[model samples]
Target: MATLLFVLHVLGAVVWVGGMAFALLVLRPAAHEALEPPQRLALMDGVFRRFFRILWHVVPIVVLTGWAMWLGWYWGFGASIWHVHLMHLTGLVMAAIFGLVALGPGRAMRAALAAGDRPGAATALDRIRKGVSVNLALGLLTVAVAAWGRFGG
Candidate 1:
């Protein structure tokens, strides 16, 4: 169960984290080269639609597996201070990003798309791009600290 839980946790994280990295790095470059204004806007709409749909599934898995790990730890040793801190901080940041996407940029993007405003969509995309870039950096930092936290203690 522990191994399975660990695998699920890591895999879920990789999908979410890796996807963001790819979007920030590889996909953005390719999209820039291969697409023009209308195409770029439409392509981005499709990209967000698909990626965020997957994120809806991935987020729950991450929460479930993460909680499961914490529960396992709780049963084993009562509580661990470092894990708690890491979990809390990472969870807060993740929730913030999710909120931004769900309530902020997500709404803006959909509104722009629905209104068929390319400039509006572009503006919304700029906001999302910046937000996701921040999120990606934070997520990577979280992963690194989580992996190496024992050393800090």
Candidate 2:
């Protein structure tokens, strides 16, 4: 079960980080070069729509499995303070950031796409861009903590 939880945790990290990489590095540049603003915004809408579907499943499992892993390692609390604190704090912060993404940029992105407002879509995309950027950074930090702090002393 612990191994399984670690696998789930890694998979969730991949989805969130990989999605960001695709969006920021691959899709954004390719769209900008290949299309105009209207088409670019439309493409982002479609891409995020597809991506967010998987996120709905991924993020929750990350949290659930994360909790299980931490609680399962109750014995490890004595192993290292950094190990436990890193897990707990990063999970809490990640959850809060996910909530913001859902409520703020996610809502606006859908609304802008529905209204077919190119400029509005751009604005909404900007918000999502910022939010995703933050998420990406936080996700990286979580990864680092998991690796370096796992057996911290």
Candidate 3:
């Protein structure tokens, strides 16, 4: 049970963090270079739609499985190490950020695209990029904490 939970937790993190990394690092650059605003924006909108849909499922799995391991296997918050607490805090923050991006800019982009408001869509995409940048940095930090925390004590 513990192994299963851990596996699920890690997979969730990988999918979320890795997806962000790919979008910000790889896809954004290539798309910007190859496409005009309308095409680029449309491509991003489609990409985000698919990715965010996957995230809806991944976020819960990550959070729930992490909590399950922390509470059920590691004997809960009080018994866990400092890093465990940090990881939980960071995870929740990431989740909240994800929700904000999805609800706020995600919707804005879609609506703007539908209305043929390219500038509005571009603005929304910029906001989403900034949000993802922050989350990606935090996610990397959390991963560092998790991987190295085991050796700290």
Candidate 4:
């Protein structure tokens, strides 16, 4: 059970982080270079729709498995190591950012697109891009902390 949970947790993290990396590094650049605003916005809307859909599933697995491991098997918050606390803190922050993106800019983007408001959609997408960049940096930092913390102690 623990092994399965661990696998699921790791997979969830990989999918979420990897998807962000691909979007920020690859897709966003290609879209900007190859497409005009209307096409780019549409492409981004579709891309985020698919990616965020995957995230809805991944978030629960990651959060549940993480809490299970932390509170069920490993030491709870008070007894856990610094690394675990840091990971949890960062993870929660990432989740909150995701929520903001989904609920705030994401919704706005969709509504704007539906209303045929390209400028509005573009603004929303810009906000999402900034937010995702921050999340990606945090995610990478969390991974580094996880790896280094294991060996440090």
Question: Best-fitting candidate, measured by lDDT?
Answer: 3
What are the clashing pairs of model 4? Answer: none
Candidate 2 lDDT, tens digit per residue, 49-150?
778777878888988777777667554445445655676677678767767876787778789878876677688788888877787787778777777865
Worst 10 residues of 3 by lDDT: 144-153
In candidate 1, list every pair of residues with a backbone clash: none
lDDT of 1 by residue, 1-153 (tens): 988987887888888889889988998889999989888888887887788888888878887887887778545325656755676578568857866775687678878889988789898888878877887887797788777774664
lDDT for model 3, please. 0.96
- How far residue 32's Cα lies from its native spot in candidate 4, in Å, is 1.0
Name the better of 3 and 4 by lDDT: 3
Q: Which candidate model has the greater TM-score, 2 or 3?
A: 3
Expressed as tens digits, the lDDT of each residue in 1-153 for candidate 3 is 899999999999999999999999999999999999899999999999999999999999999999999999879989998889999999999999999999999999999999999999999999999999999999999999998887775
Better of 2 and 4 by TM-score: 4
Task: After superposing candidate 2 on the true structure, give the runs of residues whose Cα lies further than 4 Å from its correct spot.
Answer: 76-80, 151-153
CA RMSD per model (angstroms): 2.3, 2.2, 0.7, 0.9
Off by over 4 Å in 3: none
What is the alpha-carbon lDDT of model 4 when measured against the actual structure?
0.92
Candidate 3, residue 133: the lDDT equals: 96
Stretches > 4 Å off in candidate 1: 74-78, 81-84, 150-153
Highest TM-score among the candidates is held by which one?
A: 3
